[model samples]
Target: MSEKIIFAGTPDFAAEHLKALIEAKYNIIAVYTQPDRPSGRGHKLTPSPVKSLALEHNIPVFTPVNFKEEADKAQFESLQADLAVVVAYGLILPERILNAPRLGCINVHGSLLPQWRGAAPIQRALLSGQDKTGVTIMQIVKELDAGDMLYKKEIEITTQDTSGTLFERLASCGAQALVEAMPKILAQELVPQKQDSALVTYAQKLSKDESPLNFNHSAKQLSLQVRGLNPWPVATTTFDEVVYKVFLAQELSAEQVALLGKIDDLENGAIVQVSSEGITVKCAEGCLLLQTIQAPGKGRVSAGDFARSKKDLFVRGKCFA
Candidate 1:
């Protein structure tokens, strides 16, 4: 018989693992996800991706705000699940709920444990210019993401990878890793390994304050920031009292750097040049080629196209704060 599993998670990342379990016929008895929240321009209540998938498969779902309540704890224990799998579950599971399942709880974390041990691991990895990251399946403990690891799989982080793209790749990777580890988990053949305390790194959640572009940073760092925050809280700068969001950027070439040096009295954030290649902006250490940008109330457009239509706005010497 298949193992009786209790699944808990939210967001698209979590939903992917739940979907994989269903396809694998793991006998999911119930799913726990965050409560529906108002979303989009209309502010309509929208169910989480996990909840939507659970209902489609006719699986029972719970959205308890927390397990602190005695009733909620009792109901969870009543499930009598052999194992519990968590992936990006927003809520913290108290000790009572954590020990409810016979095999205890296992988490499918986005980053290799002890590296990025908190929220927003994928974005953190890209923002820090990490060349690679991976997923880890671990036994959840009291501390956050401090669980002992059972399995792991690594993947490369390409220069072109944004948080959105990396998220999709890691989600799929986590699903496959979890599925492959299931047989060993069922037989208790896998030995969990303790993480090194000295190697622990935290990925605090992203905030609006992190979205603004600071030209004082090197061109390479700024480029990573732009890509890391893409599709959410995008990197922005002030131009003529309006916010200009930067979606894509790259470091300028040596030739471009030489051209920038020729321009006198140019400050960081100043528009150095605009051409078919892109819009070059001066930075503290180097120049950045802005590939895609968006003005307030406007859709994203190529820097070249935007420069053509708004020549007066992007003229050389005009500065962005």
Candidate 2:
């Protein structure tokens, strides 16, 4: 109950775990998060979710630029922590800092280990159309997410789950897994299992280039892409040199697919009507019904509003090009 714990995290997902540890009566001595960075349209500096939560709980917060630095490692060792709990901390740990804690470091990873073992795991999983994904608590190692598994909890990836939606669910489940495993970990009853190198896969961080809508892909793939990239670097299409963000979409049915006679005829990114849904022109595939969209310099609005604003732009057979 009184094991001095050092918590390292940066995002809301990590903050949730920190909250759980505190609530579960663990001794969280200090919290470490990434440094504040410029955000929003105004580019004002914003504190990370973990840092904000730590401040609220009156926990000492540390934002070392790099843990590999000697000074940072020294400062971390000074904590004299029995265990270091890390969740999406966004910083790599060196051997020195890893050994500083008496019980070693443990991480709450967002995906099943040996798969999706890097940043943007939740998004990558959804974008890849995986049927399910889950959390894994592991002992941190120098290798990237190559740590040994301590405990894991699985969750289904539904057809409608987005990165934002899945993130909140896993955050809660991950927090519970971490809290439940802490005692077992401290008592040395939980043994860490080495991940299989053969099955190792990386969930590379999302990039702006991945945001643009590619019509050449299938309707289902496009739908998954839209969900995975929602709310950031949103799946977008260019129409009249203006970018239209696709926030929500769905795959076309066979009947609707039949209506899209020739892809080239439909205006690329142009609005289309199929089976009572508003779809967008894609190069080689059936229309993708866009449920929500945001135009450049404007707030998010329904696809209907966007369609109405450019009524002529959305007629059937008009190609986006």
Best by TM-score: 1
lDDT of 2 by residue, 177-218 (tens): 988888899999987798999998899989989988777677
Clash count of each predicted structure: 0, 8
Error of 1 at 48 (Å): 1.2
The best candidate in terms of lDDT: 1
Q: Give the lowest summed-lDDT range of ten residues in model 1.
A: 256-265
Residue 94 in model 1: shift from native, Å? 0.5
Model 1, 174-222: lDDT tens digits are 9999999987887889998999999999999998899988898889899
Score candidate 1 by TM-score against the native.
0.95
TM-scores of the models, in the order given: 0.95, 0.90
How much lDDT does candidate 1 score? Answer: 0.91
Badly placed stretches (over 4 Å) of model 1 are 255-265
Model 2 clash pairs?
Answer: 266-318, 266-319, 267-318, 267-319, 267-320, 268-319, 268-320, 268-321
Q: What is the C-alpha RMSD of each candidate to the true structure, in Å?
A: 1.7, 2.6
